[model samples]
Target: MKEKLSRKLAQNVEALKDIFQDSSDLVYRDIQFTESRRGLIVYVEGIINVDLVDQNIISPLIEGLVKAEKPVERLSELPFTRISLTQTSTASDWPGVIEAILTAHVVIFMDDSDEVLTFDVKGGSRRSVQEPSTETVIRGPREGFTESLRINTALLRFKLKTEKLKMKPLIVGKITKTDVVVSYIDGLAKQDLVDSVLDRLKQIDMDGILESGYVEEWIEDNPYSPFPQMQYSERPDTIAAQLLEGKVAIFVDGTPFVLVAPVTLWQLLQSSEDYYERYFVTNFIRWIRLFFLLVALMLPGLYIAVTTYHQDMLPSSLILSIATAREAIPFPAIIEALIMEVSFEALQEAGIRLPKTIGQAVSILGALVIGQAAVQAGIVSAPIVIVVSMTGIASFTLPRFNLATTVRMLRFLIMILAALFGLFGIVVGTVWILVHLTQLKSFGVPYLLGVSPYRLRDFKDIFVRVPMWKMSQRPNSSSETNRNRIGAPKLRGRADEHEGW
Candidate 1:
């Protein structure tokens, strides 16, 4: 049997030489039986831990007390010193042996033995935990999720510290075999929602999944829509809070940003830090953000409409000032607005792409140079530059970049509409956008939750941040089984006791 198996392996080798041609790490060792007992160890070089394999499996089987006169008996006892064996496999042919070896385990074959012993020896390089750059907060924890799947899950586990936090592993890409984990509180999350997420993930059959963004693109409901259906965050506290609210969270192996499903448009504007601060302060910030969101989306369009067609709408003094600023400009209000908006966007993009040492300098210098040069050349008016600058500042007030970019893009469309039909066109465009938003869903929940659908219960956390004591329940859209977060407060003393005192 041994001789026949070896001959078959030689034949297989002859056929597969081309397939393994450029693989320098592939090892094939041939050994002969002697008084010392000889065998071969085949594995990929860097993937397997060399020291552990040598000290635990290889050294013991070759030079220790388990060295048998018969090779097959010795191979069975080799796993005693190795602590990490989840399973063991015995292969009869070379193809089976090669398959086992490539699956992140070391393969050991002995002379005159038809069986091959495979040792679990998976070890590779990975990054350590560090502060998340994108989601940093002065008052919160500094630890962030890393690219490794195991590390990311461990981060969540460290936060939750409960048995109910369940992680379900999934393999998405056919070629990359990328590992993605869906995590949620078992009893807290909705059953149908979990099933739906799993069903969508299983339907994906792609060649590679490099990042969480790839999974987002594949599983989202409407691929053509500019708005993102799923929310991504680097903060574990944000993910933990969502899980507690009965939402499913997806963590891709090689990305810091974890995806949270069934999120609303209003939820995107909120930051986790909002809930951590005083109610009054948080409410003030929320209102500011809401105001700026509208300003970011409508300022340019409104400016164009007023200057071009609705000049009568402005007060006489204001109109005189704007006219004076525009007297030397050569372009129409629409063209000037477009040029300034596009230039600001370009400067913002350059600031992001450039290195940290140079990014701030480039952004400031570029803005100053462009704004001054445009005004001096009479290509764009000074008032339009001020409006564009205010618009850019307002857009940054939004917490989520996905929503911010959507607002920015729609600004241009609204600008065009305003140029054609004045303020009426802007109103029409706004109504159309509101209609689309009302129809949109994140998972099955409406995007415009508390406002459009008029859920009075959810308003506690919406437009204004209510005090923690007042917030007694989770969002209704979460569909959480354990809905009540807090119980009614009890009075400290009885009325009779107070009267006696």
Candidate 2:
């Protein structure tokens, strides 16, 4: 069994050095007050705030010890208390000492004491808060969550300052020792939901978790499902909004993306700016998005089905124009559509992976040049190019990246089905998708909750986001009790309610 710290300072130092073998950045500064009095300050070199250690810890401790009339044994006996009392602690075991050092705490060992004092001087290079690159808004908070866990939590607190707001912190990854915080409002979040989330997270026994994605994969309900069960947001306002609706947010350290759970199909379609904008304008934009959603998922398949098997359904002029364009093309409609779709997807991927300075230019120029060249060469018809371009544009309208990705993958399958069975194949594929969506669950909440289950209480914000006053009750899936956002929302609000819209 491992031993506790020894009274002899030399012995403790040697044991610590043995535990942290081959560590070049492990710093140990020895302080000698007199011939018999000695101390050692141990910490990792780069992670800690070096200046804070020198000014707050090392300088104060040394000065206090030198000026002391007699030898001081306990922490209270020391005159200097610049460091907050709550941030300081004493540990006597080997495990405690090692954990403290690894987590950026400053540990001081005296000549004849078995107990060691640790100070929380955790600091390192970290990115400052900036606007989220992934989710942008025209009229919302510009600040986004930083990689720092404390900063992210602080941002949430800044938005929600309530006693009921609770953040339960837990550590995962035995090797990485990653910090994960489950944030929610106590009375708002369902008891069973919080327990279920905690249970799934506690069962994750991974050795290391490098990012939020690792935890997401482990805790998600279905491993094979392509649709993401949780929604990821880099904006504090988005997370705060989700929390108020009685959802739980998982915040993994070292990542700006916070994961919110029990998401629905409608939630994925909703955007942050929807609530900020006027209800009428937001309703129009949502309808447009819903239309484009169908276009992205079914347009290519519909095109293939129409020309191949249902040519009679089209007008003579349109069919004649389409036929004229494809007359020189050697490949069939399916092959032509597949080639363009695959090429367009490849260009999109390359654009994302390439540097920002040239990525947009490349995607635009490459698409124009390739489409023109392919048309001229008769490898692909002009109509197919236009269809693929329209489909790609529609896919970009999706607010969530994961949902968009799911649509892109499903598009290929639908296209294949359409090629084989024409309109019948498209219908079959659509039914299969609808059935799957109805069966899917996100943390026991139906994926198509308000639509498939048809909760009339939750219908106000599904197809159309009703006015803020009309959306008084929270969705039953998230919050069944304490559902009122404003008192008697239909009864009209005072000036403070901000329900003028």
Which residue pairs come into collision in candidate 1? none
lDDT of 2: 0.89
* 141 Cα displacement, candidate 2 (Å): 0.8
Superposed model 1: Cα runs more than 4 Å off: 1-19, 25-74, 82-104, 107-122, 487-501
lDDT tens digits by residue: candidate 2, 232-279: 999999999999998999999999999998899899999999999999
lDDT (tens digit, per residue) of candidate 1 on 1-501: 122244233444453354467888877665434555556667887667778877776555456434554443445654355344556677766567656666567876665556677877756666688887877676777888888777788888888999989999998888776778999888778888888999989988989899999999888877777787999998888898889788899998778899999888888999888978888889899999999999999999999999999899999999999999999888899999999999999999999999999998999899999999999998998899899999999999998889899999999999999999989999999998988888888778888888878887787788997777777787876655687767886444367766866
lDDT of 1 at 282: 91
Candidate 1: worst-modelled 10 consecutive residues by lDDT: 1-10
TM-score of each: 0.88, 0.96
